[model samples]
Target chain A: MNEIPVGSSATIVGYTIHNAFTERLREFGLIEGTIIKLLRKAPWNGPIEVQYGHSQIVLRPDELTNIQVKRMM
Target chain B: MSDELPQNPSLIALVGSPNCGKSTIFNALTGLRQKIANFPGVTVEPKTGTVKLSGETSVTLIDLPGIYSATPKTPDEELTISVLKGTHANITQPNAAIFVVEGTNIEKSLFLYAQYAKLAVPTIVVVTMIDAIKGSGGVLDDIELERQLGVPVIGVVGHRGIGLDEIREYLECGDFQPPLLADNQVFTGKSTIEDQHLWAREVAREVARLPEMDSFTRRFDAVLLHPVVGPLVFLLVMLIFFQSIFTWATPLMDGIEAGFTGLRGYVEGIVPAGIVQSFLSKGMIAGVGAVVVFLPQIIILTLFISLLEDFGYLSRAAFLVDRIMGVFGLQGRSFVPLLGSFACAIPGIMSARIIPSEKDRLTTILIAPLMTCSARLPVYILLITAFVPNSLVWGFLSLQGFVLMGLYIIAALSGLVIGKIFKSTLFKGSKLPFLMELPPYRFPAAQNVFLTAFNRTKAFLTSAGTTILFLSIILWAMAEFPRFEAPQNASTADIERLQLEHSALGMIGTTIQPVFAPLGFDWKVTIGVLSSFAARETFVSVMGQMYSVDVSENNESLRVVLQRSITLPAALSIIAFYVYALQCMSTIAIIKRETGSWKYPAFAFAYTLLLAYGAALATYHVGLLLTS
Candidate 1:
């Protein structure tokens, strides 16, 4: 789903990162098939913190929108 | 311990992800035997230290910059990749690598560890934060982990000196096994991200008994990372930090001032009233002493910063403020440099080297001087004491303190505005993703914090001894030359004033008078403003000489004399001007050296001068209107 609910855990389908900067997302191990736990989304649609394995990061909301995910049953 | 090993020293690299205790480990390993220098063609200063293992067997440890992987992105990341690939000309391939992996965050740390093993260098996994992990009720089987990874593992608390002896013995032995994964199948296009994480998870599961969560740390992070409470706490903390620099530093600053004045008086009394006496007392003592008085404040501020940095709060601060700063077309990387500017712009501009993007680095450098550096402290204190009232503003906040804080706020806002303008017009580049790892907090090492302060103090003193001493001598000559005769009825103060007016400096000041006349600056203030371009702190000493040179027998301070000499409007105008002015020639020189071009510095100077004049003009006219 495009509007992935905050505080929900999901599995990554893949990413649609279009810029040179988004390649960093892959380098940071935000690749497809990893389970991402969205912890919190900041106010005013700011940075969103997500955790995968032992790594946790705060990324911009607009940037995270491109990462297509499947909500776990 | 190492007779069988080669007599020649081996080069070892200490590579780790950011905030992985790399520097702490390096400090613990090398003690005082470290040298800092920029990597060839890059501004990232690689720290090399001598790690003596035995009587004569030592290894040179090159501390590489922290990076996640080998793919080159930033200039710093590019440097690390080049050095590791054995492509950088000045650096030879390392004999071994002490790959530091944080014990608590093995999932991510081991990924980089696995990447490092592919280079075919013999590696030892130094698991740091072992104590912290054990405190949280987690356990690591170092030997089993070593067996699993096919590399030797030594768990070390780098700051506490735990496991250091074992580490020393291992390096001295110079016998390490190869990587277990010789095929390196995980990262060699044979495996996907799923396979790599699975490998890391498998290794971690075998050797580590990690708790589901460290409850104490998790609870603390709940409040600290809270959306509503986090930013408020940050603002309140920063407010107190900035205010304490002025409030807490006052008594110490006074002690230094009193001590220097006493020294100058004693030297003046012993020597005859001639050129040598004047040069010693006024030129050398007064000029350099004025800047030296601010050293206490610089130390105090840097101590606070280093403490926050060591405590891992600064990176969280970067996280909290990134969105706000990004509005100005800057990134989280600019935060550290801007914070450094609060101490001094020279180091602040130099610290901009950490920003990966050339455009972002240049933008940060150009606006660094607007951050109300400590050199501006003396001027601010002088003006605020002379003009701003000593009464309380809102119960606890003193008006002087409030005004001081106000100036800093204005500087920060001005920097943001200027950064936005530069980004939109002059140099536009794509924004890099903000991805910073927030390291777990640890108690800061007192030695490391003090060493950082000591280094800053040394750099400040070196500048004061050389450039400041030279400029003060020239200014003293300018104010003391061409012996103009005074009228018989002229008072001592008037005679000194007339001498200053007709001397070489006075002629230059008068020539520049018309240019500054619209801002209500007299020839004397013009002289102070002109000399300050070499160094901002020189303005205070220049004014001290101009106003207090054999003028008064009363116990009146320079600030008192200045209060009588200038109007409130003029003082306010000058303060406004200094807030925006690029009054430091050293900053300009460093920018020129860093940018490798005259155009950027020239542009920076012209734009800042224009902004300063415009701001001062607006303040002057506004003040006139309000009073009238």
Candidate 2:
């Protein structure tokens, strides 16, 4: 998806993680089936907070676009 | 042997996903005695604090930036990995790790915990936010998660200061008694542990519970987060913030002026009418006074900011702006470091720890000085008030305030554009993926608010005492050295200006004058710009010293000086110069410290200087053309 609406829930699909995002995701177990909730967005909606399982994590939007997500209930 | 505790406090490195209340738990465990340093090789920040466990065992708590892996994405992310592996250049490996996890999202929080479990350090998991999900009828089987994950798990409400002592006791003993992996079997191999993924699933299914979304939160989100209205609300809130900085700070600013005047008068009277008085009143008092007058701006700015963060609106604010930032190739997580840059760029660079991508965080740090800090407010006020007329556009809005706000806006836009260009040219990388946790909005604690305000104000004053003090003395020497013996008041303005042309500073300024003349600047303004390399706000004090004028009167004090030879447009040029300038040497130093390498900071300094010179030159010569 070119644009993910703020607060819209989506399933983790695939991602193009930079070395930093990839390394952090590896530690957090952000691999297959990691359900993400698009939490709060800002004025321009560039950086976002996501709900990965019970714990929520913050990431730049660059990391999100790569991880393909399927819109979920 | 049973009661043995190490002579030194056990060091526990707290690592987890961001916003898992790891900071809250760190504060609860260590309170205010925390030492913060920018991480080596990157602007990422790590905080070190200590908590006493038992008589013999206290914990040296290092709150690492939230990272998901032992392997890092950006230089910022590598801080935890290298340090944890005992392979970092500056630090030994941490003795243990306190892996923080969000209770509501235990399965995900445990993902990182599982990674840490294999690290071979003594690891303990503190399940935070238990109270946040308490009313949801959701409770964690902490013991079970601990069993399944092969780490000791302690559930606590860190925000409320609950479960702190049990945490201490757990840290006192570094042994892990994990849950039975298939009937009390001792774990033998990596394959066996990976095979137990199903075991973790079964435990989560049995013990963890979550409730439906709370109505108040949902309703609040409906309006605050409404796509149509969200951006508008965000703009208005920012407007109120910028306005309060000028309007609300007036009384406090006036009080500061009065205090400085009183101190100058007292020091002048007591020190007698010799070099000491001149030194105290002119050099020290004047220099420090110029810095402290901006205290009102610092206090008001940080007060509103702390409240915004406490209310949990800062993240939401970031969320709203993420889409537009993407167009510039700037990541969404840049908001924190850029926001922090308003106080000082060092901390701004350091706060980049929160950004998961090294490229984005370094990019943010590189452009941070473009943010208009309170330190630069004095120079802006000095320029705008001295030249821009005091008039109202409509019935109410003061023209001066409008110009001030415009200057801030210009600085912010410059940072973003420069960030985009920097990424494309020097730091070539695709924008890294980014995400953040949105905590349920809560009324910020009064203590947190007060502390934040206190810290900001205190730092501003210290900046005056340290870097400002040193720069002021040098500027004073430049102005007063090779003293001019004058006959009368009618000795001519041209002579004084010429006499300044001979002084150490003026000579230096004149040499640089030709270089800046195309930009419409004379030698004096050039000197002010050079002196300000130490501290941006020192531009005003340097001008005051150079002109030998009273600066305590604010607008009236500088107007007569500027009105003498400088044009309305020339003064505007200086303002433009200050707007784009990366004059703070300390900011550069901070960049060096945060990046841990000369390469990124050098790149940051070079590009920013280029942008400043180009923009300033454009504003200067173009304005001269229009006015001519």
Candidate 3:
């Protein structure tokens, strides 16, 4: 998921590991097959910003690394 | 469910995701009739307010911390879930719930509502920010929404108080019905999370005609969130934030100081020239005046914070700083609390409750005091004016201003460094995931901003004022007693000095003088440092009392007196000590309350004391080397 370029959309496959945090993401509508767009990445290899289901969320790179995604663009 | 009403005042819970305008709606409904409700054995305190539904009909409203789902992930979510489930010891089960949903993002909002449906509690769905949705050329079919969810739905511009009458009417009627899910199988019989999202999206599609895009938030975020421009704008915003607190508050602060001085003079004139006069003028008036003069700065700081928060810029600021904060082993959520510390540590410490991770929250609280709070401003200004030259440096900035800025930078850097150390050592753990929603910008409502600033300032005054006033009288009595007669030929200044040296506070200072001597602090300065534990600004007032000078109008006379008696190295050392010391009693008490244990506060005090002493000693020696 972190490899997706900015301004691109992708479909979530599933989480590499499921925990409370990932469960929360799922509850926020990041369920498998949901499409999410990578808005931008913070400078200095920081967190990445993404939009999923009308909600913009910022997450660290490590968090995004746990999810598998197929690029749509 | 029981058929009869539970009690006289039905308890209603307000639940929503963060940045859903839930708090604005709460403030609108409750106005000033609100108080913090603390649950037993829980650090999180949900605010409870009385909402008047109609004539002789009112309900107790609990504003729960925002959550994304019924499954608890954070302490805040745990508390909300427990209270909603009627398991929290201090709070009764809410008779009903008001589920707030953002009109602009109904699809995302409805997902949470789907999860909440399992609770089977009667709920009224409030669609807030309807104006924003309509302004962008969208429409919400409330009747369709009501039919889709099988519950009452009301649309409201919360801050503007539109569509609120219908809500009050519904509540007053006391006929709330639990959501019926007979046809909504997407949420029935242990459905998967994906099914819930599908149901919410389908319902939103039918009931909400969303605009093609939210161009307003996008246009602003283009610049505000740009990789290069975002940080620059953030820095500029911070620059303005600090500048207004210090420069803008000067005139008002001066007026307050002058008023107190005039009051002191009037009291002294009416009272007899004896212990009574001294106590009235020096003990009560001077001590309280010294602390009260900083009120303008506190108000300004709170105003800026409230405006930024209400306008939805705080979350963007947090987003911009998340990476930088990660370097210090903290996430973006720590930014707001740390920023509040610059105004005062007590509020800053309390605001650390927003951080979801326990270790991160504790570390943030432990290092919050290291930020240069406003209480340290007077001490810094007094010392800098006395010792630092006033000439311009680099042909533009004044040397004193430069030094002041340098001190602030040093304090901030030290706080970051200490935060890193604590995260690695005492609160060692893996880095937690950082997730935050970037709320869309809105024009802050004027009433909410001012009310927030007013309430915060009032809390600060009442809490810090009483402690300082009590300590001031005790310090005054110690300095006024055990008086000695002046020699026939001695001057008034000599007699005053003699009386102070013979007093109990003076004797204690003399006895402890040797311990601080290596740091270039004289007996008088030692006394000031000791008294400062009551509050940081008290050190300046203590100096004024010891020197028999009025610091209310200006510190000019006091500065001159200090320059004559204290060496340059000593002044710098004192400034260094003030910069590092955890000297405020109110802060310590608050830390104890927030952390629910004395262990952290005790460790904080001991470590800060050692750091202050060591830094003062190092600074004193450096100054001596440069001078010699």
Candidate 4:
């Protein structure tokens, strides 16, 4: 799998959700087919802030390591 | 529905939208021992106070955050929505609700009341602030209100401690289950909204018999809430608040610094000249002292803010700012969190729960750190007082103060504008409608103020302390290693500082100086700015580290070392860096957790850092040309 650099737009293919966090995400409507834009990769690589569904939000970067997105120009 | 359910005490929730005086009622029911904190990842932890009934039964009085309905669009409102349904891990069953409503605004509250009625929890309506009603020539018919809603209605005047028992009695009694809507009321398509308009009108007709409009409050709101005047009023309110933070906190700050200094001196006297004294003074005194002095500024800001919020001016301010907020696709409720940002972004981001739309809420959270919270104040004051001349701008504005004010506004506006731009360009969606219930104005509750002050102060001492101390030690090491000669005592403190400067840690600051030079910062300022990454307030203490400055409760001050040492542009640039820099590590942690992805947090960091870099660069060069 080629690693897509951050800042590239991607369509969320699927996510490996931490049960509690996933349940919490399901509550806020985060699921498949969501188009997301990766905005920044924090120095610690702890998390990423992305523009999703009309709001720019921050989430753990590993949460995205599984939720695959195909590169968009 | 389980027969094996443990006989834990029944719960009584003090429920209402923000500013409905639910907290006041909570304090009245559960006094000093109230436990206040944020719930899980969200900062909007509804305060819960345990109370023992006269019958030897115990009840946990959970004061949920203010929300407009049983179902909420934003996380904060979801606080009410979640607990009411017992879906939250913390709450297990439906019990009873003490629904608080502002007397002045009855119609808007009915919408909430009607929603709660469906939850089947025995509910009581407590109408707060009756004394002001008479002055406004409005009379509430308690009997008619009870008759109309088919529930017991009790009116309490919270400020003077009047009608508090009636509220207690109604809560204890808890035998009413009113129909969700009146016969004529039509249910809206959203099951959550049981005829919002009808319930609003029901509340208006039955509960709000007469509005006690205080002429003074009205006049004040007239100007403050005036579309044109409101923003000005908000600015003036902030200006006054900033003024008090600087002026009022000085004596207390001095006292705290002196106390720390005394502690350091006493420890030095006992230990003699070595690592003990160095560690005690530099790590303990210098590190902790820097934070303690800031305690006063934090308290004052929270105190005045709680008062203004209690008095109900905050809601009107929200209403006033809603139009402007709309321009950027933000909601008026975002104002409170933004306002909280001025004190500290941690709380500011936490408070963003009050905003209902997820998009708006996240945007508000992202931008809240931009508010020039008091944590940044020490750094701002340190720099401007050191560097910038205390001159009047345009023959009226305090140039220094206005610059401070401009930095704050810039942070807030940039947050909104960026959020808007993100919404328009990067994240595509129309702005959500700004819907809120304006709580009727009342006297700010005194007990609530103390509780709030205590909570924030405790957070500062504990949560804030642990984070800063850990970061300080790391940064100190960044300046401490690669041991160099201890310069002979001009003073012991001087020797310790020379040790710090020549140490490995100090070299790190020098290394970072070139990167920050565009912002008019020297290596020392660069180091403080970097150390401040742990928390913005640490900038002041890092400066203390640089200067070997010490202080205590009796004889101490930040102005002493800062006065002659710093130039104006350096101070301005420092303030500018803080103004734009997303230096709070905690905020990034929170954002990561809240959004459930690392992607957005990373985005927040990159963009904020970029913004800070560009702005600080501009401020440095522009300031140099102007000053020279």
Candidate 5:
């Protein structure tokens, strides 16, 4: 999960959304069972853009580190 | 229908997710008939417009800040949520609400709709971007959606006049019923993010037909979002943006300056000599004239920015720069506000509302003024022209232009350094998620771009007319009072000098001379710096009036007089000072308005002025050392 291949599609299994910024990610359709595909990862493990249900969003690596996802092989 | 609903011209709150085309729909609903103003005690502008209902009844529409859910994540979202909940005392609880959703992304859009439904506010869901969804081989069943949600759902292509009549017809009927779902079911459904996602997805499945891939968007993103190529492209675009501000606006600026000069000449010829003529020709015309010349630069800047925002490239640019910015502990969202600061800090600070994290938003606001705003341009150009030689380095770069670019670079570096310090010390340990959405690129609509540019230009002109006009008159009187008698056989320069020396401004300048002596500013230069506090561009006008009187010759430009009088060290010091100083009163006033506290603006002023003084002192000594 830490080094998932680029352009891989995954199903978010479980994730920890911190209290300080809750509801924002969910509002963008990033939740458990929501299928997401890594569209592009910025250089150096920086923020990456993902396709989340007909929309694309950028997420910092630090924020995504805690989110558990099962890559669809 | 509720008997308690307000009579004719009922208030309707238009809410939606960001990039859902809420503003476009607002434009569609209201046409060229909206007025934008801030909610009380805050800087978020709620655009209000009136649209005729069925026959003759017109209803007021409040276009709220875009948010994903009723739960507030940012100050702007809180404003929307509070207003809907009837807790925001500034605005009345809306009689009804128009919940706009992106039909292409119904899964996420319906989440907000469900949240709004919990309030039982008689909401109508307006599905926007229906054309884009259809183009991408997706289907949005509006009738099915209407039946499932128990609310009126109308698909609309906001830019074109699609499905607008249906919306108006619904509003005109004035028969909005509360959503069919019970409050408990709407608010308490499984009470988890996963559950909500599942619920929204199920609803979307029942409503939407099919969508496999976003082929067109992905094709563009493959090239535009490439790691190596994307950043280079973004840099090229920005270079053009910054370059145009200088090259493109020059002619328009010249035209404005010529017009002002002509007016001043006409006034001087017609008005009787003495105080009346001097005040009208020199004080009023010259002072505001200098500020007005900057109008073209501000317009060109916002015009480019609005175009970028409209075309949906700004968010992608933000994504590209986020990593570099994150290294300095600033979120990617900070990029937009910082770029906006280059045109003017007022809009820059206002746009900080987009940043989700309070800490990041605050830090961005604190450092935004450090970005060299357009107001500093007049002073910079004047100083650079007067002191810096117009020689080319390496046969490619003009020295003056390079120095101008150097000032911008220095200001930007200062913001990064300041941001780093604030991150580790003042705004510590707030780990807010940096999640940014990138909307698909589209050609910018001309009307929206023009409207944005027009609004910003109008704001600038209005401020000039009121604040700058008032300050000009006051400073003029200060320099005009306490007239002195000229000695026999005295030259016109001597008489002018004597009058200024004896005037209130001159005395104040002389008194403050010692305070700035360490920075190498003389009394005359000190007076210019002092007057600039009202508005930064006023520095040039103050200098123009102070020096124009002594020149005597009509053709001798203020640049020559400045060159002859001021030393290189002093001019450099002034330029360095302006690079960091928060001298524009409007910026401070806006900071106060946005943060809803004088403390932040006070801190902003103190820190920036300290930075300015220290930088100026260092620059003066360094220049002296190198020259000697």
Candidate 6:
């Protein structure tokens, strides 16, 4: 997930750990099989901005590491 | 249970995700009839307002904290869920819930709505930002949404009052029924997040066409969120924010000060020139004026905050600063409150409520006062101008200006360090994963912005104002009593000085003088420090009174008198002390209210006092060594 290029689309596969944070992400429409686009990453390994289901969310790098995703062409 | 219910005014809860225009709808619906109430044992204060449903029928509208889910993750979310479940002791279960959703992003909204539906409260779907949907070339069939979701759905541009009449009609008619869930659609309070997301997506796809990414937002984000340019833009924006507060609010503050001075003069002229005149002009008027003088700064700070928030830039700014603030164990959201502390810590501390995490919020509140508020500027200026030379330091930088800038830098550095220390010691916990919504940019609604500023300023006045006024009167009495009889030939200034020397505050200052003697502060300086607790700027006035500096004369006379009485080491020590001390009564009062306990504010006061004393002691000794 960290290596995903900006503007690339991906499908959420599953979470590495289930917790309140991931649960919140899911509630914000980051469920499995959901298509998400990597909008941009903040400078200095800061939070990554992602677009999923017409909503843009900023998630820290550690949080993004928990979610496994498959890149789409 | 039935008997416990209120006899009238059914409670309606407005629930939605953060930045979903929930507050805008709330402000529009309630207008100016709202009051914020703290729930028992929680820091979250839900705002409730009386909304007229009909000619005589009125309902209480409670605006719940925005939550991403019914399952509580933060204190705010916990409060929302507890209130909705009727588990909160102070608030009864709302009779109905108006689940506000953004029309442009209904899919994300439905996920929370699906979980909310299981609570079985009669619910209405309010799709706000409907105009944004149309502008983005998408369609929302609210009627179809209503049919699909089994609840009354109303689409409205809340800021503009469009479609508000339909919403009022629904509330007035009292026709809200519990949502009728289909067998497969029943959430059952046990649905997984995945299942809920899928269900919400299906429903949203069925009823509304999802809008494309807003072009304007995307274009703006490209520059504003750029790695280099984003932070630069953020810095520029913050510069403008602080500059406006100082530049714009100064005239209004000066006007308020002048008005109060005129009023005091008028009262003095009418009242008999004795304790009565003193009480009326000094105790009451001066006390009230001190609190009222902060109104312009509070209004401006809150107005800027509301504008940034409403325009959807605050969160983006938070994102830009998250990494840097993370190093200090503070989140990006803490930036705004800390920035606001420069204007006044009262508004800054109050604004700390925006940080969702309890520990983060508390840390921000605790460190806000360390940011060197405007109240500390007079003390800093007096000391620097008197002691520091006006000669240029680095070819162009005036030594006086450089010293002032250095004091500000020191205060900022100490704040970051103390914030980190507190986070590690007292507030240590697992860091909450930083998750924020970069809400789409939109034109800020003028009504909402002004109302927010007005309400916040009003809250400050009502809650903190009374404490400040009361303390001001008490301090005034302390300084005014124990009148001394001077010789018949003594001048008015000499008599005034003698009176202050013999007063209770003077005696206490003399008693505390030995304690601060190591820091090079004399009894007069001690008295100035003690009196400044009412408000930091009072130090200058107190010193003026102690030195008998004529009010008609400029600060030059006062500065000369101060320079003659106080040594260079003492001046440096005083500057060091003022840089760190939590001297404002209003800040302490607001902290007590915001933290919902005296414990945190008490702790804050103690730690800052110690820091101030130690810093002053160190600075005084260093100055002595350099002079020798």
lDDT of 6 by residue, B225-300 (tens): 9888988999999999988777788899899999999999999888887789989999999989988988888888
* Better by lDDT, candidate 6 or 2: 6
Q: Write the per-residue lDDT of candidate 4 for residues B1-628, one digit (tens) a residue.
A: 7545433437777788666667777777788767764455554556777776668765788888777556564566776777877878765454777778767666556666766667766677788766766667877877877776666788887756788777555545555454444333455353423235444555576545564334565466456555466668788876776567656777887799788878988887898866556677767666777556657766876677677777766655555556556677665667767776675565466546445567777777777777676667767766665556789988988887986777777787777788788766665662223333334455666888887777766766675565555555665555556556664546756765676677765677787678777777777777777767767776776677676777322113555566556565666666666777888766665565445456766788788888888887787778788989
What is candidate 2's lDDT per residue for B173-215, written digit by digit as tens?
A: 6663332332334334533323333334445666687664444
Error of 1 at B581 (Å): 1.2
Where model 3 places Cα greater than 4 Å from the true spot, the runs are B1-9, B38-42, B181-186, B287-291, B336-362, B374-404, B430-432, B481-499, B502-504, B537-572, B589-603, B620-628
Model 5 lDDT per residue over B225-320, tens place: 789998889889877876677667778878998899899989988898688899888788977885676677768777887898888888888888
Best by lDDT: 6
Lowest lDDT 10-residue stretch of candidate 6 chain B: B181-190
Highest DockQ scorer:
6
TM-score (all chains, Cα) for each model: 0.84, 0.80, 0.89, 0.67, 0.89, 0.95
Best by TM-score: 6
Note the DockQ of each predicted structure: 0.50, 0.43, 0.68, 0.02, 0.69, 0.74
Ranking by DockQ: 6, 5, 3, 1, 2, 4
- Model 5 ranges with Cα > 4 A deviation: B1-9, B54-56, B183-189, B287-291, B340-362, B373-405, B423-431, B463-465, B485-493, B534-572, B585-602, B621-628
Residue-level lDDT of model 3, residues B100-206, one tens digit each, is 99888899888888888878888889999999888988889999999888889999998889988887776777667687763456456646778888888998999
Instruction: Compute fnat per model.
Output: 0.35, 0.65, 0.75, 0.00, 0.80, 0.85
Worst 10 residues of 4 chain B by lDDT: B430-439
CAPRI-wise, candidate 4 is: incorrect
Show where candidate 6 strays beyond 4 Å: B1-9, B38-42, B182-190
Q: Number of clashes in model 1?
A: 0
- Per-candidate RMSD, Å: 4.6, 5.1, 3.5, 13.4, 3.6, 2.6
